[model samples]
Target: MHFLNRGRKLVRTAIALAATIALAGGGVTATADRASAAPVTPSPIAQAGTAAVKGSAKDGYQVYSRTSEAIRYTRTYDGIRVYGGDLIVRLKNGKVTGTSVGLAKPLSLSTKPSVTALSARAKATSAFRGKITSSGTPELFVDASDGTGKLAWETVISGWQPDGQTPSRLHVITDALTGAVRGSFDEIESVSGTGNSIYSGPVAIETTANDTGFSLTDPVRGGGYTCDMGNRTSGTCAVFTDDDNLWGTGANADRASAAVDAHFGAATTFDYFKNVHGRDGIFGTGVGVPSRVHYGSAYVNAFWDGAQMTYGDGSGNAKPLVALDVAGHEMSHGVTEHVVPGGLTYAGEPGGLNEATSDIFGSMVEFYANSTADAGDYDIGEKIDIRGTGAPLRYMYDPAKDGSSHGCWSTTTKNVDVHYSSGVANHFFFDLAEGTGVTAYGTSPLCGSAAPVAGVGREKASAIWFRALSNYFISSTTYAQARGYTLSAAADLYGFCGTEYKAVQASWTAVNVAGDDFCSAGNDFTLALSAPSVAVDPGTSGTVTVATTAINGDPEPITFTAGVVPAGVTVSFDPATVTAGEPTTVTVTADPGTPRSSAPVTITATAPSVTRAVSLAVSVNSSAGCTGTNGDDVAIPDNTTVTSTITIADCAVTPSSTASVEVHIVHTYIGDLVITLLAPDGTAYVLHNRAGGGTDNINQTYTVNLSAEAPNGPWVLQVRDAASADIGKIDSWSLSL
Candidate 1:
């Protein structure tokens, strides 16, 4: 299948759809469009071990900032590479500052493969539908894309496509032990999925100045250029050159005609990504990808081969496949490949997601252009008649309109072909952008009695999708994960309380994709905290708003309670129990004796069988209270020791770790003085041991932990002059419990 016109193509390319990067920071196979990567050195701590059981950066999956001095490493268990075993280390001022990891759990398995390499290769080759010209050695590796790391074999099958005109490179993944077909990545990135010919008319295109005249290259935009395939199936194609740079006559016979649409599509797609999504280029590095037009005689498809975009002239050269949306669609595949490591795997639900990503972005690009000749709409390949009939390749508003696509999800959603399974997400994106029922685009239907949804507009919807795809999505991300990540993206972009966040939840549900957490739409109520955490001093109080929204039903009585309260801390609810809807106030008070420490506090709301909870980090600050002072002075001769007692009483709790002691000693040689605190249990904690030379009095405050001792008892202050020089006296001393 190729871009937009999946079935229109004679044979599948199998390259673009097959390269899935199971792990972030992991290799994307040497031939996956990008240059072969060098083996990433692993940090000493980047191991597939128990560290991931803790669910932290220590797990080996890490994120790095481009500006930070961070080195990324991919792990290998035994001998094979551990795909998800990724981590990053950062340095500051020539010192190791921090590290993070991505492994979800420890991976410990025998590297020895039960299945032979030939057997694995056979299994992988059997899955490849195209004719094979050659096969790669079956290499062993750890497939940790699913979080459960296991031994797997990767085999590359390269050859001519079934069409015989286009080439095919299919990467098949097989389980090493079971020899079962796990997944595959194809070279052809299809939209199953438009530009002109005959579609978009009289469009402006950028060109580069050459020695003779002008080349179909946009030096202003990454130097990407369009070329003619010369009706040949293989070999390099000559770059298109024009004299006046006037180029196309708005006709396919002009040769430069289809080239005009292809070039405009690449530039428009580039602009849409840069201006709307802030992406620098197809690969985010500001580097442009080349586009080849008029590929093969009467060819019927266009594809984003890991490296470039190739468009075939339609049947009889009468209908070229270079429509604006189709161009945008093919170029989008490159963005997907570059944005997400090796790109989304081209099989099952992930493959559908990959296709839907292109379609959605392509449609958005068309909308962004809003060309007068070809007005934007939520349709794919509406201009080019790739389907023989005048119908568009796929309808975004109603994917099922094409007959094979599933508008709603089901148990077998993951098992269907990527082209058809994409219907779910395409329908969802449409609902998200235009809402359900009649709209400017088309009327959208709801699934399984889903709640009515309101549109969030294309700008917000596209932003949310791009954010999720680039940041939160992994190669194996499924519909459920997509739902969660998109909601997270919406919340990140437009706060959880806004209409945008709610629309994300509503739209996903409208397409029958359910998630655990919802912003405002569900059968039960929803709960969220205004602030995730708070800090307060002892004897003070902090308040957090507990908001609850009843979704799709009436108020279910929700009783609010604090899970665990630390010592000297009291938690109170404004209204302990209420019907879930109105916001509740949670007041946390720390007494004067509360210690300076932080702990996780869970605020739970229970109603019937539904329970919602949020964690609030409570930090209590210690106070300088409970001080016992004595103003009377004690005489101390040279080399003699004098003790002062300040009895502590009426203290409710033991002293905190930050207990303080104030000592005032007058001496000619202050270096001879030593001060200490004696607890009621006779446990002496040294405060200071003489250090000054021949100085004056020593007046200072020392902080220490007295948590283990009694709060109400005699706390003695001991001062001694170790050196026999200049007699001194203990002026005064005090103890703060």
Candidate 2:
């Protein structure tokens, strides 16, 4: 197998250019199918306080079957990219068939930010941890992945992790008006190595005959070729050329061996998506993703660089990370990014889900290959022996057996690394495919006393997962959102809440991910917030539109009321009672005396037959003056309380009715710590009481009112570590009075 690696970039660029021209909007631009006439502005629920939702759409890509076609659209609002706002439309012949939208609701907010780009970047800089290399310009957009629209400024902070080896590209989202850090996700997704023409024995691979020799390039599949990196970290790779078309002898020394595995993997994974899911190719438009094997002298990991795939020779340069499933796993990352538009952010719950997605498809592809030398199984990296223990890197049946991965969802699940945190979804998938208790794969333990989930078979499970990924999931999807979307996918595939849907729910519940019985009643309604979040100054007011739609239920009168208003705030809903298809105006007024802080105000919507509640984020602000910070790191001894101090000098002013406490702590599980800010007068305001389930780190801003206290002395940032084994340090803390 021989290929010219020097021309790789140029070929990819040409394919991309063709796709752009075809889509009618270069990679970033979009074209909308807006009607020729002026659009109706009264639709989409956000009927007050904003102008018409101006937007456009461009065809990102499309796929086809015998009689049906699916088109993907990359969208923008007011001239800005919309994160989690992708749309997919399926049609038969010239008629509409189905459609999928990533946005929770339509965008109807100002693109302009109250906070300047400089200010937003500074906020992002603080949220970013580790050593800094460079930063990106702040971009503005509407973050509507959470069922509501928010004007946000996104800043990408690039750097190295604490280890200085693993790089970081953290995208931090900040509220444009309040400057509060809203959300974050990393760019670098990681996975370890394993492979064989060595792992798969002597497998048949496709190659293209060239003037010089037979090259390891598939002419039938977008001319995708596998090249050797010559054991270098980065350089031009050479295609493995051979005198004869036959290649690989089941040895790592033969570079063609790894290339065979990689080439075959790319082909098989492409076939899996095309034959089973109706997706045409990796890019959905016949564009093949190139692969570079033998990436480093002794690299132990492999990764997807957003454009192509790269594999490393493991320890001693004896093991190439090019196993069939490994290749499938790496390429599936590209698929996730391609199919989901922006791909799931590679951090927190989203990252874990993304990793699990790769693993799931990797196993499925192995099964699809049906090679006698390498049988499909639930274990990951088993062929490579990644840990040098003859055991796989992860056991889908019982992930915690590795002593790191989470076997079930918990308060601390989202706090762990993406690889280990992936155990929850991984285990859930196993349960869905093989059922609970014991199976051919292994024994999968139930999270609690939850009922068992019957096997739905791998085909059905995979279809459900793919449907959710392509149709329902977006970039900020959490395990909770995943459960809902998968349920919807299951309903779409099978009948609503039928055996397949119930199996999905039961499997999720068995993994400690609780969800409502959405199909329990035929009558139901959905709620969406026009403005999900707002930053209001003390003595000021902000409004949100509570929009409702009837779902599987008759039109009924729905009553809206405040369920969780802050102590010093008053909430009143205009037209408190309306039909299910109507919208209500919710105004929250923060009194001057209200503490300067943020909390979720729940608006409960009740109908005669059902009840639903949507939460609104509210933060109160005042002029900042009493500011202090302690930047020293304090070791958080297990099960012990540690304190840092910040003294203020504002003698005349008390404190903002709601004051902000920005704390940065590097911890294994911040969910195990109770963090409270103590006033100089000994009054304490609790910020976090062992939250986030099982997620890690406490590096964000928290707000609460400083009540009846003088801002003239030391204000203590107190953290109590209530867990054992895991530990961290209080990196820094700041006070805004």
Single out the weakest 10-residue window by summed lDDT for candidate 1: 15-24
State residue 704's C-alpha deviation in candidate 2, in Å: 9.6
Report the lDDT tens digits of candidate 2 across residue range 349-394: 8778998998898899889988877788999877777777778888
Best-matching candidate per TM-score: 2
User: Which stretches in model 2 have alpha-carbon errors above 4 Å?
Assistant: 1-29, 38-186, 192-197, 520-538, 541-553, 561-568, 572-587, 595-645, 648-661, 665-712, 716-737
Each model's lDDT comes to: 0.70, 0.71
TM-score for predicted model 2 compared with the true structure:
0.75
lDDT of 1 by residue, 456-515 (tens): 899999999998876566566678768866876787689864888889888989999976
Clashes of each: 28, 29
Query: What range of 10 consecutive residues in model 2 has the weakest lDDT sum?
Result: 16-25
